[model samples]
Target: MSKVSLKGLLSSRGPSALRSLRGGAASALSDGERLAMLDELEKSGLGWFWASDAEGRLTYISSAIAERLDVPLADLLGQPMTTIFTAAEREGRAKSLSLMLGAHKAFTGMAVRATRRPDGAVLRLAGQPVFGTGGRFAGFRGTGADISEEFHREEETARLARYDSLTGLSNRHRMAHQIDSTLTAFRAAKRNCAVMMLDLDRFKHVNDTLGHAAGDELLKQVAERLTRAIDRECEIGRLGGDEFQVMIPDVDDRGVLGELAAKIIAMLRQPYSLDDGRCVIGASVGIAIAPHDGVTCEEIVRAADLALYAAKNGGRGQYRFFSGELENETIFRRRLEQHLGEALREEQLFLRYEPIVDAAAQTVQAVEAHVCWNHSERGIIDEEEFAQIVEGSSLIGDVGMWAIREACRRAVLWPDSVRIAVNVPVPLFLSENFVGEIEGALTEAGLTPGRLELEISEAVFFGETSIVDRTLANLFKLGVRMTLDEFGSGYSSLAYLRRAPFDSIKIDQKLVAEAERHDSRELGLVRAIVALAGALQMDTIANGIESAPLLAVLSDCGVRYLQGPIFSEPVDQDVLEQEIADGSWKIDPGAERTRRARRRTVFRKIEIFHDDYAYEVTLRNLSRTGALIQGLANVPKGTQFVVDLGGGQLAVATVTRSSGDTQGLEFEQSLVDDGSGGLCTRNRVSPYALASAGTPLAALAPGSYQGMVGGLIDQGGAPKFGYAPGGRGD
Candidate 1:
């Protein structure tokens, strides 16, 4: 309709009609004045007014909109309102526009994008339902305003809130809300969800040495790897700093989660190429499952955090499942950390040397320096435990420098030909004064630089190339040999060999240990590494060679140097000096090769039973095959009994040797290997079994599974052996 026709309609309806149309905002204005104001508002270009008939066809629209839509008013007037304006995708308000129009209900501020506009225009529509005299449904008469700019601005704001600026992954806030919503829904559905908390092991070192730009670049690369490693359905978020979280829905199996965690760790541990830096960082993951581990956000997150702490504590580059035990252990770890600082300050720390011998020459050519803590109150602490206590702490660098200095000092007492191999932590190796520190130690100790070999881990290869190369060159110029330690443990990048100036490769103990387990694939991998090292003109040393068979295998595989318990445990500096004075010491690789099961001389009390009686026997020596039990007086040679190995693990054993209160019992079936290199039973006594036996339980606790043993113990009867009630009388 023309402007003259609109004015005529308002005049025909009088001022009362205009007042109702304006919602009484301009009630004092006359009919002609209101009509002029409405006409001017439509022509102002700020907004447009539209009227649709009962069938949803546009009866009237501002002439400007009709022109903007590239159609004449007559042609546009007959078209369906839905055809002219459609809901923009993902706009919440616009999605329900059609439904609201269909309901003939009054609605306001419904956002919709114009279908005919070329610029992808968004409009906000507000209208009240227009009814006929009979109260019958007519159509909507709404005002539309251009909100395209505001719409995009809101969208960008939302994106910023949800995404990480650096890696473009989800941010922590988004992850928290996502996890909260998912867990809530999953809990109602009685399904499971898992959360993995990961932290980069050496990320801070990258930031400190190469600057935050390289660290940010490294994190971006890490995020990309994480995306590839995790399932597409899983939600990954950068939880600030070097921390990240992954949410996997419909997964509760520890085994599957473990594999996923391993994949993530392996992928992230790969070398990252920054602008001018080659960065490598390892990740530790802690996984928590819903219902089993926790049910709510805080509970699950805390569980995962605890598990992550445990993983880092158990030495980085590993994953751990959340368990109740970690709660108590975390407190102990804090105490250990505090004590470690004191130990370093009080000079209670000492060094032990494990000889790295040439398998072919049968001579000790070098010794790897291991730091040990002689805690005044806690006795001797092993390297693994101490490493866990000091990892990610400032004390590590102090201890590392001390180890390097002490090793150099001690090397002066050894033969000039004997080299001292001291481990260089990634943090220490990337430090600004690493080369200076090495030179200072060598100068102070009066030791030649060549005699002080530096053992650098594969991790050090993942930093700024210029710095790492410069550090390596400086050490090389000083005549120090750089051996790449733990070669295959992380990325096993052949790229390191191509670019790095490593003089030798220390084959990771895992590969050697895996070879002993009869894994042909692992054996082939070890051989391949040795062959690769040989091709590169770098010597390969096999570590963790405890078995003679593995030793023979390594020797046959053409490995030159070897280190492990087979030769000797790491000895003190005094003993090391004595060994060096004795000249070359060698391990006899052919020394009585045996496949004997590893036996632990544990003196703990264990339950053994035969027939209807259970005996509290003292475990002397235990192995996968059998156990030596004391306190069983008249046990026959072939007497059969079940031994409770704690944690619901039970083994049926038969007495093979018996003398007085001591008997050697053999297991009916072999025990299965625990993932941690420990042993557990192939089958466990189920909680259902315990319940069926009329003994109900909430959960099985350690040592509480004694009741799970079949048959009743004759507790009222006389003692089985002639020993004190609490004493193991030998």
Candidate 2:
């Protein structure tokens, strides 16, 4: 193409003209033509334009350049380009000019800013150098545009991405990225850092009860407070909905970090002024230190999370540092979770009976069934070790059902007068299906609802009060007695005491245990709790009574019941039953001996009949209370019988109670001694008449009586005889 034609095409083209200039006809133009071509290019609508000679002087300047500087083009031509730039841009522009003139190379897309002479409007300029005629630097030409608006837009977009729109604080995404980068830098430098995860405790309640608008205002205020508390060296972020993260970079001493955390806690301790004039909320902080507690971002976050859980679990609004002990506890908890399914399926869980004694009666009133796990290797694990695992897992409801069923089954075996209290997990208490499970268990076990007591921890009351009220109301409707466990440990003391349908409140061991040891605040606390329970017309059971002094204190405090090792240790069901029987059983020689002789005669023959199928026997020495058969064969209880007399005569007999080979039989009519000693006697004389002879038959011997009566009493205590029919033995 001709030089003028090429220059016209390049000028007519846009930024794409630079690509064509790289290796095409635009390079074949003469130096003057290139300069003239550059001069013509300045008239294009893009922006200011300029041309430089091979000597690095300004050869041509377009009217647009003068207009950008607010000067005439005739006054700007033939001046070195460096003269047009400000002192700041002169050196850079001069270097570009030198490179173009010395090496015949072209440069493009060099961004520079210039100020207009009169109005001082800021203008962005981009320049390119042109070469021609034996590879000489003919001129430098470029365009510029006003990009202030574009620059501002880019900055605004970046700000929105990094900051939370609601609170105007860094969001979790940006915080995470910054923390990760900080950790990487710290690791390379072998430095230490700390991360704090904060949870606004009970913030949800405020939102639900007060309103979301109020909650939003509260969060904004919290963010402001946090920002003011932290310095430029530290960064704070809102990790979505009442949770926040703080990063303290380059922390060498952990104590310093702790002090900082303490400061944060103290700052949060001051009440937050919510939109609702005076409502306040508190925050819990969990701290994890890098290189000490964790080495990676995830590890640090997890450690902080665990510490946060510990803080909340220890009753919120506090701060805790990640420790080795907590890590070990976490591992132990994971192990428990791993094995919990098997434990539930294999029936490895059992109950221990903690006796609840009636302080007034000074007798064992009832036993509370405390579930325990008999781990094969770990021995017995405490509730704290596995209860949370059960609660946090889907197994909570299943485990609760199993506990209720097993407790009911074992409880039915207890003496009818003694009620058995079983601890129902808090989740079970909240579940809608809890009442159905209890009803089903009671039906299957044939246990009365009055005999079964369900114990629930005080934590349930501290939860959603509405939920607690509804759940407890349903449970009460099921006729199950409810005892509030760990009564004084929760916040909603008076509220729960007034609202819940609790039959009793067991004083938490903490207050009771300290009541005897210390005479100060703890004693007063216990006394207050007892007084509260009493005022509410609810029974109070003093727990953790280890010493007589504590019991005495409990008694003095007017506590109705006491539980702990002081009265009786938690024992197995069989052991508890044996203990109760041992304490209550009496020995009577005369009555026992007579009963035994009759029982032995009856049982021995019953055994013979059972072994040989001999079904008939004669009962002599009959009385209103009992009857003895002299020529009777052993028969099982419940067997119908017709006693044959003489000719077509007959007497109907029914087995009432049996012992081994002998059976206690009831006849429709009492057998009377005819005194004739004729056919009625017939080799079977009444044992009473024989005893009167003073040469009583072997059936009337005291030795046989003792053996039979003893055996009968033993069998009577068996669970299988729950509803055995009584029999009067002659």
Candidate 3:
């Protein structure tokens, strides 16, 4: 019915080819000429003809198409049409190829990919069923042309539309579409999905200090690292600037989510080597689970945002699960940010000094100055409580310079042997007057340059090569010693050490803890750092040595300076003066300085449920990992009990040790800090869940949940383990 004239007699390749077939002599050419022209057209690489028998076997295929497909015409002639063309989407071309052939119907414009073409050679095909004189159906005769070039162009355009050009990760639009589609499908199936929001810390600082080129380079590296870090099934995307989103399907357990978040943070925190210089950055993660946190995309995203804000407020480089209280916490952080500038103006801030000691001699080497706020109403707030808040403030430069000046002013009054060290913030260290400010502080207090130490982190290296190099050279010539603060917390690049004249390396405290807890490769890394520092004629300091095991390991590993609560907590100037008033202060290596997991002794009566029976118990002690409860008799190990810790909190725990009237319960999921020096569950049973159980989500009696959840009302028998007289609270 439809016809296209041969432009050059044509050619065949991947699809089908015209062999001995001839078109109707519609033109002025004779039948032989017309047939010759059609054959020439097939060989011109434009189009080809193919025919199949009644059994759907390729009965004839032109030599041009066979040559294009890299097969002999004889080989392609007898192959099944379905076997000759295969596609990834078997639903369309492949399925229809089989179905349409069997249906004995004409099909036009069927696009399919050749089975043998790894280059994804596509062909547009049109076919008509052939019938004999008796009207018995034969197979199909068709013409197809390769459309690989056009297909690849359209695919590239679509990829550019959905992917980030800079990072090659999914773009914001694609991520949003994916989240929406996944959540919708999952909602009906009653499955859980989770969303994680991650924002890079100090990314803008990198852009401001280094050039935009460096920032772009940093983002690409980040994408690669993120891909490697997230081994689970998920989609990672860049949602513009330094923000990223991760959609994880079929995950709702906060404990598992916490570990994954921690892994990502750890990976991102490692220092990155760039052409500009080596730099280290961190990420804060906020997570929200579907249906549990929200039922819609908007709701889930907002929940994740609130959680992210809370993580930033808590200190960057941490993860937080969404909770109802995060909304209020985010607002309070905003209020706190506004008040920070006021705190500075009102002189509500003070300084405390924590000593970094030479562990072998048990003598103080240097005391680092820290900022503390004495709010008129909120009492005292430490640096950890407000660090991230200050980092985001416009007054970071002012605050950094103040700490340096104040530390010098106070240290000038101490004995000459007691050197003072001050922390340098990223923004302040990059400011124009950074070196000038330090010089003025030293001059004003009559403090010798040698007696002052500048503690700088890897973040300072984000500046331009010339600027960072110039700044370091100027400071080194000024006669002050420099220490790399929080080493291994971020970019632990040996590249920086190769050039920067740091007098010492302060190992990140968390690195030490992680190394000791797991005896992981981190311990080897710590040793390598110590060896490297020793070779470079630099000292290595490992802080936060809490336990005896940790201290012993660090000591044996040749760490030069150790600082932790085990040595002495940060102290007021008055306390420091009292300790060193006579001579050089010395602390003997004693068991008292190291920290042990703090257990709070509690004598409160609570309820524990087992097998739908509730037993009144007295809580003897509580810790983050576990709890001890009295008032149960003959409780066997491995039994699970839900502890009602009052105020709608329920903790799932298992009995690890059972003695006569007391049981030590190990929590299935560890407790999280409640921010008031207490422990609480990360997530609580929501009112919606209660409502789903047939009760209205309103103000019900204190014990109303017991009947709905524990079936306590239906139980008329005594509990399995009755309360014993000795287990009662005194």
Candidate 4:
């Protein structure tokens, strides 16, 4: 019967099938017969068919339709199809029916659940619309099928594809699509947007300690927290393990983006309770805004990635924004790094020496060696441009060591009295081989420790005092004098001043220039520093004394050493030696002598003793009396001590006060010991020594008697004594 039914359907092609089902051929069928045939067909198969008029009223329904709806055919026909459909299906079915009628074609795959009448048995409908003869819009008919299992299977597949299995949130694939679409819309609208890529810092630590399951739970919780943190205007997506991306649309102010980044950082900083509240993780975020950081998707992603790298480099638990300056700086640094390796190998680097002069003495006491690079094509590259790159690399230590060695070698060529002060990078000081390098340089150059002063910027003493202390101690043990460079510009910790093994401090040029302006604050600061340095027994070098007024001011402040362009520009070794030879390089010796005299006058006497020797020292005159006594360790009290008064005169001294190692003496007698008694006698004890008999011993180095009794007497004014004792008469 099934085969006969199929054969009948196939043989009666086109509209003949409908006509055959009506009873016979189209010419023999009546309308009543056709309707009766449709009813019979519905009873024959599990499928159902329905015919609706143009107005959507059912003119006829198969018996199967009545069975599917659990109703009689009479009750189903001549009724609106809406009665058989749910609210959603009613609209869908109506649209399908209208489309099929308008197109005058059969429509299929209209699915719905319908209840049979009386018994109320449920059936799934998959139906099609039917066209009348000559392609006229007539009615709709289709089959009903059971598809409950199929519907669930399709939904499960979609769920797995779109969501993260662990967090139930949109995964990377879905988020990427969403981001692309959103960005396209933003671009079309000419609106600005931002993309933030975040990575959880130290997330692995939690996973390793708490297991992968706990890690999964933590990620789930993190997703929820992040979603809650963002506003509805933003979309958050998980870009796989420990990384997330957020898209912010219609953003106006970048500050708001920064604020959002800060907020995210803050939120992430809060402890994440996982594994029953035992695990925690922090997050770092990098943000890139459109039309500024980048224009296209790839560019934005790359910018965000760079920003992320910067954030991680800056340290975790923070956020950074993409900046054009940062990008340029990064590129510049990379180029510099690439060139720096070759620069060292090619010996493109050289040293420039700036003389550290004693302003009062007008002598080059030391030369500060500064590093300079003469690029083959770029001409001169300033230190500020590449200093940071050098500092952050291993090259800093190597370059610093090289500087020390070169400076020492050059220093050995200078006068024995000239010291070379080499600037040392802080990292070099911390290097384990720093001491060895210094020793090697010293040995190679045969430079004395006293002549090799290490000038360190004040920044070195700021961190890890113990390390600085140890480094200073090691340098001191090597007999290397330390000078604080750029003194006032740095932290200038008083504690470091007291603890570090520093022998001198160079007043920064800024302070010195300000002091020259008659700036009270600056001058006062300089004075205070000078006083402090004096108290600490540290030598003070006033740097950047450019103007004569400033020099005068420095002199008044009792600054003994100074270096600047006003005095003498930094000259090459040959020029410096020529200047020294010409005697035109003379500085005012009077100022330095005056300063020393003042300092000496303050001290009563310095009785230095070696072993069990003692000498009674007497202060003759502060301006000219020699500071040292030779027989202080052996001469007895009350013995006629004939002191050699330089140009062949003898000054007799008697001990007046005697202590264990110190003694006070008085000039008791004077005589010409050159076997002559005339004024021109080679040796003569003059009245100047007698007049200075009661003076304190401290004034001896710069005493007036020596100035008067020296070989050449200044007879322009009051008759100065000839060859007075303790003067540079010889």
Write the residue-wise lDDT of candidate 4 on 368-388 in tens digits.
Answer: 777777787767665433454
Highest lDDT scorer: 3
Expressed as tens digits, the lDDT of each residue in 343-417 for candidate 3 is 889988899889888878888978989888888766777766656667667787888888888899998898888
Candidates sorted by lDDT, best first: 3, 1, 2, 4
The lowest-lDDT stretch of 10 consecutive residues in candidate 4 is 672-681
The estimated TM-scores of all candidates read 0.67, 0.46, 0.81, 0.38
Instruction: Point out the higher-scoring one by TM-score: 1 or 2.
Output: 1
Cα-lDDT of candidate 1 = 0.76
Model 1, 46-162: lDDT tens digits are 757777778988866777666655656776676788887777655243466678789888887687766766357677788778777899887776777777789788877888899
Among these predictions, the greatest TM-score belongs to 3
Each prediction's whole-model lDDT (CA): 0.76, 0.61, 0.77, 0.60
Tens-digit lDDT track of model 2 for 583-606? 431111121121111121112222
Per-residue error (Å), model 4, residue 531:
47
> Once model 2 is optimally superposed onto the true structure by TM-score, how far is the C-alpha of residue 449 displaced, in angstroms?
2.6
Task: Please identify which of the two predictions, 2 or 4, would achieve the higher TM-score against the true structure.
Answer: 2
**What are the RMSDs of all candidates, in order?**
7.8, 29.3, 6.6, 32.1
What's the TM for model 3?
0.81
